[model samples]
Target: MTEIYFNLLGNSRESYRKNLILKFLEEKAGSGTGELSSKYIYYVETTATGKKIYLLRPANLNKGMDFTVHLKDVQFRLIGPFKDRPTHSEIIQDLILKKEENNLEYEKVKPLINKLFLCQAVSDEEYRNLHFSKGIEIEGILKIIKWLFIEQDITYWNFSGRKMLYESLRINNLV
Candidate 1:
């Protein structure tokens, strides 16, 4: 599974947040977790005001789709699937070279993630109805990020010490 999130302090003057995340990911990809880790490293993209958004996926999971990100309060869509497995560098090149349309498989999902995970919005019946697309459940997506960041302790701070996101998931029975 792949996970994406909006950085909480997105437009702050400290532009080095992006560099720090890249450096950490690069080191982990190169030597920290070996070959498999490199295969599934995280990718980040920034908005015009310097807010950083990110994505992560496991090597064996979905190849993921190409979608566009709108940072006017953080929105995304899964336009289509990838032709081949993409590396972190390849993704960076694509992002730098063009307006990269990336993947997720559902158009409305990421904003929902922002709301539930970052904004700490309480989930309700309407949310459950909207959580499925082509047989994929949003629960799996939530689990992926939770495991990687909270359980694995990779950039654990991004998820609010696992408080907001985890409580939202548990309340909604999504994890």
Candidate 2:
């Protein structure tokens, strides 16, 4: 079975986080088995602010699978800014009513919807459900970011260590 790993940090101004992560991943990628290849690693920066995001997936996984992972990761990273971000219900409502009108698939959209709910990022909910464990919440967010990037065909560069993942997050409407 394929496994995913994530390391999340609170806001930090340090410039080396992306490079540090890239070096660590490159070392693992060089192992050549039971780990993602360097080619499968993708780095995306927000178009406006330049906050960076990193994505890793096994070479063998399908594009659809990879896309889901990217979305989860992006959602997780976005949670820090909100007193609580949009809830799963609110996101789903928007997707179904608006985003789907633009031709996005509901199945492809459900995971992100669920993730937003679980993360307590949705500020619209009147009563919060704190049922999900912290570990599950983190995993869900990582998976979402992975999926979103793949689906959106977001531009990503190879692991360069020179660019930080946070830079990607700083850009555009992605946050």
Candidate 3:
């Protein structure tokens, strides 16, 4: 595979945050447990004053859809519906609605992981209900991340290391 270095940082005075993450991932991909996984992390940064949003996306697009594993402050959201349908974009709203109804929080889901075996933060059962598509359960989609934790390779730090991102709330802190 070719080494992909995205124009990534744009023209920020100090792109330390992005560079830190890029370097870290490159290291993992080059010669680490992460090297075994076909998926690599891709990110998008929006530096809008005090609120900077960093979205980590996977380079491999879904067949006719897009999949997203979004982590904001310790909360990880697995999202996808394959493609557009009767109603759309309201997906986030639906998540918000469901979250509100269930009173769910990251803390609640954090304990579900099988620390001794899978790196997965959620069980196949827990992931079942998060689908944006109509009543479909999420399966192989998240299985893609199993190697990262199955061998105890990647850690929470990859998601929110101090330099990897400017202002990040860590899974470590939450747990």
Best candidate according to lDDT: 1
Best by TM-score: 2
The residue ranges of model 3 lying beyond 4 angstroms of the native Cα positions read: 1-94, 104-122, 126-175
lDDT ranking of the models: 1, 2, 3
Against the unseen true structure, what C-alpha lDDT does each candidate score? 0.34, 0.33, 0.30
Clashing pairs in 1: 65-102, 65-103, 66-102, 66-103, 67-101, 67-102
Model 3, TM vs. native: 0.23
Q: TM-score of each candidate?
A: 0.24, 0.26, 0.23
Give the true-structure RMSD of model 2.
14.1
The candidate, 1 or 2, that scores higher on TM-score is: 2
Candidate 3 residues 32-123, lDDT tens each?
A: 33555544333322112221122222324432112233212322234554231111223223333433444444334224323312222443
User: What is the model-wide C-alpha lDDT for candidate 1?
Assistant: 0.34
Q: How many clashes would you count in candidate 1?
A: 6
lDDT of each residue in 139-158, candidate 1, tens digit only: 33332332222222223344
Q: Give the alpha carbon lDDT tens digit for every residue of 1-175 in model 2.
A: 3233434331221322343344435433334544433344444322122333445443234532232223222342333443122333333333334332433332343444434323323221211222222222322333333334233322232443212322243232122
Error of 2 at 54 (Å): 12
Better of 2 and 3 by TM-score: 2
Q: Model 1 Cα displacement at 132 (Å)?
A: 3.8
